[model samples]
Target: MQQNEFAIWQEFDPHAKAWQTLNNDRSRNIARKLGIGDPSTARECLDCHADAIAPEMRGDRFQISDGVGCESCHGGSELWLNSHADSSVSHNDNLKNGMYPTDQPIARARLCLSCHMGTADRMITHRIMGAGHPRLSFELDTFTWLNPHYKIGEAWTKRKGEWNGVRDWAVGQGVAAENLLEVLTNKSAGWNGIFPELVLFDCHACHQSMSDRTWGPRQGTGLGPGVVRLNDSNILMFRHVLAPIDKAAAARILEQTRGLHRATTQSRDATFAAARRLHATIDGLLPTVAAFDYGPDSLDTILSSIEADADRGEYRDYAAAEQVAMAAQSVVVAFENDGKVDSEKAAQLRSRLDTLYATIKNEDSWSRQKFRAALAALRAAAP
Candidate 1:
């Protein structure tokens, strides 16, 4: 019923009078796994693309095919699909004629990063989750090498497409987490659409540990396997990108990497514990800078509060609490910003923050409820 409901990338090759084949079925499987109802439906895929416009009217040219399209990453088969058998059309000719946006390795990385990277073309709304879809991640060569996600058989490999060999998919070269973070950190780059610093931790850093028994019910405690190892190969790559800006962070990263390899190789579990602690610390620090909204506290208040707490110079005791409070406040503000001034979004933000605050710790003296009330008033005043 949606627009472009029938716009799937049909596998049919007109010249051969048969369906074009994919060596691996991962794409089809992922579509089904996403529970999109009908894998063949074009609208479903479009829903995840630029074609799924918001209620707000925008330029008519904003097509969903601009992102996440089969042809967007793969080649547009319109010409080749129908004309490959004309004898006049060679494979190279088909490539020349097709509209494969992600033909080169770096370009392919960029194409996936368009949404996954969470830096480019993000639509902002004032909701607690921020506007638009959250960014995923990118691992250029690694991505193409993912047999479960993409098919890189001889047919695909031999083609001059975006995928480099799987071996090149290592942590070093491609758009790992670190690379995405660099693009995101640059305010001039316009990657502020997604929540900040989320890219710091790997997906498993949150998702896997979320299912762990040791994770408990702590708010913002992080959700995943709680691995102590530095899973954020992206952050390593990010450090390289940011090295030009913050020498301290760069040096610290190098030090951490050296230590991390030793820890991981020694006792994986112990290393995971250390990594979890480190991740928690960094995770707490990131939200303030990423979204830059701290609800009733404001950025100045939040930073001042943290600095004031840290000024006590007691790293072990109450100082850590102060840092956590500041981080929590920042998170609350981010949620509020995500909700914007919309009634529904406001309610969602309020609920998430209140719940997280309650579960994180029982510092009843902080008066989070009072703070929530004040933010509610501000939301009512916002235009």
Candidate 2:
């Protein structure tokens, strides 16, 4: 099969030779699937693989391919070359044709997300974009532009390719959301899965400074890293947005999120202890959430569930949760009452949640760090 002209070529740099050798195998196809390109030579590698340059380690020249390119996620590029260019090719086709494989959302997202989102391994700690290559920001919907060669579509069409964008979003949201929930539980280990939960700790609602703060005693006693204040407002944000989906579950999830936030403020020992308690509750709750049949018809069931259980009853301890539940329920009503969910209604719910989240952050109780962390997820989804 003939390669297209867009297929630029560069001589491999000895420094990058190792990754190049690995990339030269089928992994190159996966890069193409991701909409990134494959180029030889250090300069060209930087051209397509700018992510190679550590944001923190700039100014030094290295042979390692900088930006995550063709071989990074897909595996060695060698075996699939002949079939890759064929119009009949597919991600699974390439896998069958012989390339190290992965199909699960968690695994695949972890790979692409490694460089795309910036994690412990591939920290935002680098800069390849300004080094004369496309920037490495992430948005699952538009990211395919990075791998135009594969042509994954809005819907999975065989001729287009075999990919699951929806599934990716679902699992990514679930995992990322859960990770945030964990960090809200405890901030000291915020970087756990490399998803950047600390960013959520920026309580724009309460904190005067984004990076500076001292919530209370350091976890290690002597004076460890400063703590960020968090609050319960976003806990309400969660209840509002999620309650209409399932009130009892939403309330439970909100309290659990708050519990996680509370954990972050305490010592590691306390945090873990809280985590164990929270995790047990979540273990039972999440499976039930997963089992919910949340199609169009289920909307009424959710609304009734919320209506039957008032805020004064089982969920009295959670103010943020109640407010958020109301906000979320309002959005659901607006959505169901009308055929389409216009931007106005969505924005309204988002604004209410944001205000409530901000209000909680300003409170004297929970750390402000906790409030923002919980709200960030709502902010992303709402607007």
Candidate 3:
């Protein structure tokens, strides 16, 4: 019955709209151009936009119309469905039965990124983006908070321990960085025909208008025009996350991150070698990030590091600036919730945050100068 219960889930799901919008004749134009007869029936389109589970696993009760239901992230409900109903059953027992171990921050992040960040099983190529699919960007804590189904409270804490936004954010960065490296290393999924998957590279590198004359040399890359660069937004944010916990490791990661950018201009072999080294470094730090507690002082330090990055012109692209804006808001909200910021200061921070958000709200008109000024104002207003 759960599988056939479409009205309960699909009626409210935002993902269901992806299928609904694409199945229509008007939206299928791009898909048709790409040789896909009908996006609704196309295997490639169904993989990410809908629940494209194998037919054998999907019983008669299971239905794809329920679009990204509980089973999507929680795993199949067969084993634990009945056992989970018993009040005496502990959370660990339910997990042992079949429930996904989503309570673990890193585990949850990996599950979310499997879809958001793409994987070997489901690749989000540049062709898909060209077919009107929006550019994918995800931060775990932000998305979790945005999800309407659950709340983090006493009951949730009892089941999953205390919810830490900073930890989620940190784990998310490491997971995304790791995922990118894995994608880069995978021959089957990383390459499309003869061209490397352009979707993985920075969009702004080639998507900018011809009239834009703002191209300049970046010390981070040491490369000139026409060279596609690896998207480093996640790695850049991860550096700020590591600064308060381990300054030396953070500096080393930053150096390798720049090295990776430079390697992109050289050859595929060099890029993969550089990515492997950086991935190992990030993997080593994930455990510390998982266990560390982010107190008020640490939050302040992290925010300060982000501000420093902005001042140094590290967030020149809209993608990096958008991530920073979201991270800043998350930190400020967390501080406010913990009573670290007084009401007056909270109001001031919100005003500054509004300006920061406005700067990147419109991608076509996003100005690096306006965003930097807004970021400075936000730092000045921080308590």
* Cα lDDT, model 2, residue 378: 42
lDDT of 3 by residue, 42-135 (tens): 8877776667788998967886665566777778888888776566888888898788987788999998888787987788788888877778
Whose TM-score is greatest here?
A: 3
**C-alpha TM-score for every candidate:** 0.34, 0.44, 0.94
- Evaluated against the true structure, the overall lDDT of model 2 is 0.43
lDDT of 2 by residue, 28-47 (tens): 54444434566443333443
Full ranking by TM-score: 3, 2, 1
lDDT tens readout by residue for model 1, 231-273: 3444433333222234465455545545544554455354445
Pairs that collide in candidate 3 are none
TM-score of 1: 0.34
Scored by lDDT, model 1 comes in at 0.38
TM-score of candidate 3 versus the correct structure, residues matched by position:
0.94
For model 3, the superposed segments whose C-alpha errors exceed 4 Å read 1-11, 16-18
**Which residue segments of model 2 deviate by more than 4 Å?**
1-66, 84-93, 96-104, 116-156, 159-168, 179-200, 203-247, 276-383
